[model samples]
Target: MPELERDNEVELAYGVRLRSSGVSATVGDVRQAPTATRPVRGVVADELLGDSGDAVARLLPVVEAAGMRTVLAVPLDDVQVPPTPFGGVRALTGEENYVELSVPGPDPDEGQVVLEVDEVGLVRWHIDVEAAATAVAIADNGTALAARGVAPVRAGIEQTFRIPIVQLDQGGVGGQQRGFLGFGVRKVLHLIRFPIEAAAAAVGKAVVGWWEDRRRPHALSLVTPESLGDVPPPDGVSAARLAELADKPFLVLVHGTFSTIRSGFAGLNRSGGGQPDLAELVARYEGRVLGFDHQTLHVDPTTNADWFLRRLPTDRPVTLDLLTHSRGGLVGRRIADPALAAAAGVPTPDVRRLIHVGTPNGGTVLASPKRWTTLIDVFTNLFSMLPEEVATPTAEAVIELVKQVATGVFNGLAGLTAMDPGNPAVTAANAQVFGGGASGAAGAVRAITSDFTPAAEDLRLRALNAIVDPFFGTGNDLVVPTQGVFEAGDYRVTDPFVVQSPSAVVHTAFFSDVRVRAKLGEWLPGAV
Candidate 1:
């Protein structure tokens, strides 16, 4: 310990080193001229810094006049955790009380230092290692008081300073130092995400409840046999006659991301600059329309698709046409399941026609790789695991736990080489969806291989495949990729224009430029 003497007053300073345990001090600073170094006495407030803003603000002035250039004042970054001092102050006033104050000393070990302050307001510190700690957290009796987001108290009277040590790495990763004195301790914060399975289960239960309430009343009324009660159609409504054929060749339109079925209806109710609703487009041609809803943000893509497919009515023979966008193409592809069709109480669909507008056959690159997966997981979980009002700090803790668990699972699976291919769960997601994967199956393989980028030059091939390739080998639109838009067994639209089958014209528009939507009414009479 070094003692400073001036004007009949002697300032004594001592040092203390801490790791994980509350530190103890032998000689607290004593500024009285007698030079009697004694342990200062004060109760450690369960709270770190006392509630005196003015005292904290006046700290620099008092320490500066005492010849001390550096003061350690730990501000609370997170109230729920410990307080860390990343900021520096000049000095402390005699009024603040601290039995023992930990200071960064001259000698540092492994880039670390330890120091202690006494009542004299003089600080004795030592560095043991070459690495200088970047930050410190202050606490009282193990209670963190101030650190990021907590403003320094502005009072001018007596003031005390305490801080938790924080270490900064070259790569940007940061850590807190173990507590050295009094009740101050180190704590860390982490980012979190929602658990897919847990959230799905919760929403699944909710949807099931909703189904029980609305199922019977709705009962696929679009296809239910209802005697046309001789009632006349409303004056402005033009679907009077088509209402009879609504039960046959029912058309269900599934909107893609961010769009709702009501969107089309709203558009029909109100004219817009964009394309008109299929109802109006088909109304003149006597076509009927049906819309389906599936969870958007709260549900996973494959699960949502499965739910939508199972909800379809397939009990009797039926010709179903589908129009989808974005990831909706995946829904259409999955619904081709014979079992799902049967479960929907509808006959196997006659494989009539399918149209996908701006569908992402493969996963989007934006959701691929590591960072994006974490981001999506976080966002989806925010809506899933937390109520709107729960403190973000609490929710964040929960989410972080979920993400850690998910990451562990992802890593475990990623270690595997062989796995079932047909299992829907096994094949549905990307290994890195939450992070990493096993065998690089459906989700994993796609995440690893697909290029979902926005760069223009790379898009030429993708755009060509998206529009022309679906008809490859036998024929193609030359825009959609063959492997994506077209199924393995389908050749109807693939046949050359002249050799085209009877369904060619009906499916022609599918392989042709999207402009064909304008003339669809020619064949279907009312479907435009």
Candidate 2:
């Protein structure tokens, strides 16, 4: 263990070094329990790990058995790493490179530590041949504060990494303000190593699990009044249920990205302040409502539509009405594409009515490759601030995506890319759905969009808007451009519902608004 003296560089265990002029700090082996625990104050371990804490509990024994060591840093005061230049022509010539870490002063309002770098400097580490290095900040409770992958400068033996400057405080979480760093809260930093193949495999497994659990890929479930807000059953509706609804017009619920039926539409089950409950629509439709849970990350909307069509009962003709949110609108449009329907050999002549709430029909700039990191940053903050409104599983998925992106392994995620304004899929889908006429078989499409600008009092939200608004260059509901939902290419929704500014109706909170509910009642009054 060593203390960082002002203006002097201190070498610590594991080839690590620290030099700072204005802060008191200590660096020690993380395996020393007390030293590791000191910095991670105020973190609720259960919140970071699962309630059981089984993951770490299981790892400690193995670490002790192998006699491994990890380094920990505790900053007694605000710290700054003087500007250092390391990567340039030397790096191009296969030489060592350096990176600086910029640690910001603690902000009482934000309870996390954020790692940033003004210039590219690599933190080099010697690791096992099979391992990949990563820099991670962890809260006492085990929540990941920030993580960045290390790039190998020399394969197997040497690695270099720069902590990305990611701002994770944009909104209030559970009514309280919090940042990704947990700054004021105690925190610890670790340069961890894991088998590259194993890490990749685990991420792949987690992605599959997230898609299986939340997306339910091509599954359809009966949404009854009693089950309006419940998670769709794993097995979906049985054949008997399909037979019972044969030849009847049904309303299909198509949820947005990283969402399940319950996560997307559950708000409809509750009402207040004289606001009408969406459940009334379920009863009104004579219980002929269905929820389509499908993949929204790895596959494009057309693929999702293809799967949905394949699962429909071919013995009977089906007519559909659609209620979609966010990217779901694209899938709904694809489902309604007459050509796709013909290809699937299903005689779905037209969607009787389609109601798009926060749907990115035209596409969103956030989905573009350059904006992927920003997209994840926005969602991370939003999830923290509006936990109840955002889907929980999606947060985990975003974290995984971050790791993948940091490692330079992220492909433009196909499902999200489909929403990119410049993506070919967006152009193709819009041309086919709106090309022939204003009303393709999607029939009478109406939209619910919002121009959401946070109020002056909502500092964090305003901050988030500041970061996101530039990309849109227009009004948006945080994730989707306001105009994009109703107009694209050759189409313009004649009288789309607009949730004007000065309102708190974000993309996720659209269905929770009284005005939106009332509009739903007006548009889809059910079986009448």
Candidate 3:
């Protein structure tokens, strides 16, 4: 162990070297601890053991079983890396100084180093570990920087890796204003390595099990008086209830990926100052509103639609209007697909009107296989700032997905791939649903889209947008592309309600807006 001084590289214990220039901070000796101890700090600890801890706890065992023997803890002072030569900062910051580590062995397992910078940026690791499939730099807040297609650079016999340890301005977002003070606590960097294949298998198993336990793929519950707004239904829709609801044109609510009906439409629960709300919408359908809750991470939308169709009563004909958000819109479209309905051996419900809020009909690049890590990064940062809009469990699901992706286990995530522009499923769906134009058999297709640019007063959101806007070159709602919601292949959406820039309305907050509520009321007219 040695003390690190400015402009001089010091060799610490375990064949690791530390160096710093332009930045001033006290670097502590690197110590090793067992991975079971969970030696983590700042936002990483908060994400792992937060309110959604139980949901994400399954990931730890996967990491431990991947031959991770011990964790390395590196301590440093509060440091901030200024904005890059470019306008905005990326997920990884401060590439100038490097923390080099040498593993003296013939062969070593795959390893990872988790670094945090004042709860903002993450340091990148350039690994030359032999036979390692990939090297990823993960931010404390669950942002992963991985070389997707590129193979890891293999050096000589002695495996040596250099990690860029940097800092972020504590005065910026998630700073003192947000009550994140890192004064006395030691900022420890946890380092662990494991076999890639074994880790991938373990991650896949754990995540699949977790998804199976949490998601109800074919569950459909009605919105009754007892389960009005953001309240979970006591039970699934019974055969009698379905027959009764099928007598009239009912409304169906479809939620997006990593979300439940209660969480996705929670925004509709807010009072709209004499405007229409969720209660009014439910009453319009005479309490016949059905909510489709399905698995979103593992299965494709067609599968979800098939499961949903199977739950419908075959004895009666049903007519329904659809209200969908995000990926749920894809499922709704599939349900509205007459060919698909026929294939599923069920009569297609007469879809009178379909309202898609923040739906990615044209697909979002963020869901591309290469950009999956960036998608997680965007969601993690957005959820950190807007915690109230997203439920903790939903956020935890995102966290778990990111963790699996970071560990090179992103092969089986078909649901996310369905949102990719190049995905055949998306192309086929677009061709079938919107191919016949807006007046197609699916009925009147409407959308509520937003190009969210944070207002001047929303400093935190603005700061986040500054870092995130670069990922999506065009206008977006911080998740899906703005124009993609309404503009598909040959079909051009007509007269969609668009939320312009420089507003507080984000993708998740659309239903909370009075103007959106007004638009919904105007379109549906609620039992008038």
Candidate 4:
């Protein structure tokens, strides 16, 4: 890396380019072969190229290989590097790269993939929920940060970063391929940009996400505790709907904690316009839909299960088809639990199928004391990223929110205790749902405990998010490390999606995901 000049020309030891624009011969000729001791240098200026002295060394060899006598820096070549606050770039597959939230953390362990916050280190206290919050911040603010010069990497759970493999022109540094970055003879800068449309899309999505969460809860509490007994059918349903339910098997969609009906099915709004192909799961089971909502934060699984028992017919010959997401899976589990039902004074419903979109059947790392510190630190950083005027207030708000989470539910709410892995209800559910042997509950618990934790994650996590961190702990969905819905021995009656993957399915998304929807179609009796 060299010092950047105001005119934008980057001065190398050998010569200077008009800019690092990656154009050929735009600057004075300087014949420096990359193989030579001296290297080539150049730069260009535009929206995302260079500003305030962003430079890189060892670029000469690559440029020389591209065969250009004059300097023409491609804007994309230097993205994801220097002067860029947002992106964190690393080799995903060999020389290829992958861009992520780009935050700091301890390097991963031998076989794990941990995304530890540099400050938080690891969860060590009730306040560590902030670390979990920070992970959320990275996800929430990721796109915004990318807007300011982050490179466009390939997309997928386990995708490639497409690094440039230079092929020197036959004519060498002054040849036909000069200035080209190897795309069938073109000198184009294919990189990400912060376009007006993108910003608009972000705004639109935020609004959509808001309305989705806020709008669905008041359907006369069709799924809420307030509407448990003899509640009128939800807004759009007709009186005939009850009769329809009696004749046909019904689909019950259970939402996770802090989620709404739309979140289980609809897509977040686009930053520019319109929406993604959200609600695919919802669409398939259209005729048989029954969305369930509940007070998850303060309420226990037994309470939610009781509501489910009250809402559905006790003696329906047909079992209800169930689709549960995140903690909703716990509710579904309770519905399936005869003992729990008996204890709660509720009748159990027969289940047709259970598809989970990242349920913490084994609880979450965010709840681990050793890991919460990291969670809190990351969230605090997110608040710090705000403007000073808002930062203080934002921090205060976060503290208050955490306070509620801590106190409102578990009498100090376990300090956001419901999510705690150590929660009695959560552990009990895992024991029952996964079975109690090594091949069952014990194994899954061990994986979630040793493999999913920040310490184990360092050794087990992977870029594909495939090796557990979201792939194969026991297999994980990033959030849920088991990579599956349930264990083989859990039950022969029906299968359950215990651990989730792709990060999306770990919590809020289920119906909106096509693969998930397709799986539902295959697994459910009448789903299309």
Candidate no. 3 TM-score: 0.73
Highest TM-score against the true fold, candidate: 3
Candidate 1 vs candidate 3: the TM-score winner is 3
Q: Model 1 segments beyond 4 Å from truth?
A: 1-246, 263-279, 282-287, 296-315, 343-345, 369-528
lDDT of 2 by residue, 147-223 (tens): 21222122222333332222224246457664322111222343322122233344544233343434454678888
The local distance difference test score of each candidate is 0.28, 0.56, 0.59, 0.35
lDDT of 1 at 275: 40
* Tens-digit lDDT string for candidate 3 (430-489): 665342654355678889999898764444455455544665788889889899999888
lDDT of 1 at 216: 13
Worst 10 residues of 2 by lDDT: 115-124
* lDDT at position 43, candidate 4: 20
- Candidate with top lDDT is 3
- The model with the greater TM-score, 1 or 2, is 2
Q: Which stretches of candidate 4 lie over 4 Å from their true place?
A: 1-244, 267-286, 314-318, 340-347, 369-400, 403-419, 433-475, 483-511
Error of 4 at 250 (Å): 0.7
Which stretches of model 3 miss by more than 4 angstroms? 1-206, 213-216, 224-235, 385-390, 433-440, 456-459
Residue 489 Cα positional deviation in candidate 4, in Å, after optimal superposition: 9.7
Q: What's the distance in Å from true for residue 404, model 4?
A: 2.9
